[model samples]
Target: MSVRGRRASFISAGVRFIVILGLSVASCWPFRQSQDIEFTFLLPPGRVECFYQPVAKNGSMEVEYQVIAGAGMDVDFTIVSPHGYLLTSDFRKSDGIHTVEPTEEGDYRICFDNSFSRVSEKMVFFEVILDGQGAEGGGDDEWADMVEPESMLEYKLEDIRESVESVHRRLERSRQMQTLLRAFEARDRNLLEDNLWRVSFWSCVSLLVMLGVALTQVYTLRSLFHDKRRVHT
Candidate 1:
């Protein structure tokens, strides 16, 4: 084969290989679809439930989540970081799209409050879509290998959910205690007021009795003195 022809053949092979690799990578790239993940929690009135969404840690981006409330109930949401920072907060907003951005790769907490709902929240969904360049990586083997035992995102999120749950339980107990205390306080106040009113009523009655006795003594003395004065005159 001529030297130039041989070189041309080698270049053609290289181009084919490059094209094949490009196609393979593009086909195997991670899916960044929003519906890939779904998280739901049911909280009774005046309670909060939280969950985590896995995200790419290396990039600077936001986790955009779509929240749909079960008919009749609205949701109030707050995004907390692994470190317990309020990254984002919203309230009284109807079901719609929301976004949360993290500074680093870690657990991001989305707290769903059910207190806003008078009825049960039958369904709440969280769908995570990568913002940019989203790569889930190559082969099934490569994908499996990239997954850590527990991602920082998962770990931090779990911790936050636990914290919120603990706080939720505490809040429930506190509310109950406060209600009982208020009942007791109200009863005591009413009883004391009633007693006070009764005491004043009796005190006034005693004062009138004392005044009546003094008047009787004065009249008796005046009658005796007048009789003596009349006899002397």
Candidate 2:
């Protein structure tokens, strides 16, 4: 539009940027913390894990996982939803940390399933560290207290029971898949074995046919030679 209007727009944009920067700096100052949560579960089937983490609106989790185990089996992770939906992996840190930012606010269950191979020892051990929450406002003690601490994430268990069921359903699905694969392999092996004797029998018959053809050719050649000898005589 007009020069004055254009100037006003630029000034307005600059002011908004300054305001955002100021708020960001103030938030980093940090005052109080919400809560700390920590809990562990012994996986009956395989290793499963969950940690309360605050993810950015567009960033990874505010809480990060650090896994340690033999062959990192302690870190072998499978994620599932309580609603019978499978969760996908977003990112894994160099230290075998997993992080994801949820776009929706609701109950989410992540299972660290290691129930693939029966031979594999059902071993999965892992822990996570949580950072504080973030928003445009500076975290006040009142606000922080309203939130849960990173260390005390156990309270979510009661709140996430349905999520646990979701995990169970996912595990069931995994089991089904494994069973199907095994059946397929068995069928393939049986098919191969069933045809083995037939294949061998046919191969022997073909060999016999070739031998007979050779013998007939030899007899025909001998007869021709004897005729020529008689003519020479």
Q: Indicate which candidate wins on TM-score.
A: 1
TM-scores of the models, in the given order? 0.39, 0.31
Any idea how many clashes model 2 has? Answer: 17
Candidate 1 lDDT over 116-176, as tens digits, reads: 6665553454444334324344423454564333332223323433454466456655764
TM-score of 2: 0.31
lDDT of 2 by residue, 24-47 (tens): 434443432222333334444443
Question: How many residue pairs clash in each candidate at the backbone level?
Answer: 1, 17
Q: Where in model 1 is the C-alpha error above 4 Å?
A: 1-36, 40-44, 54-71, 130-233
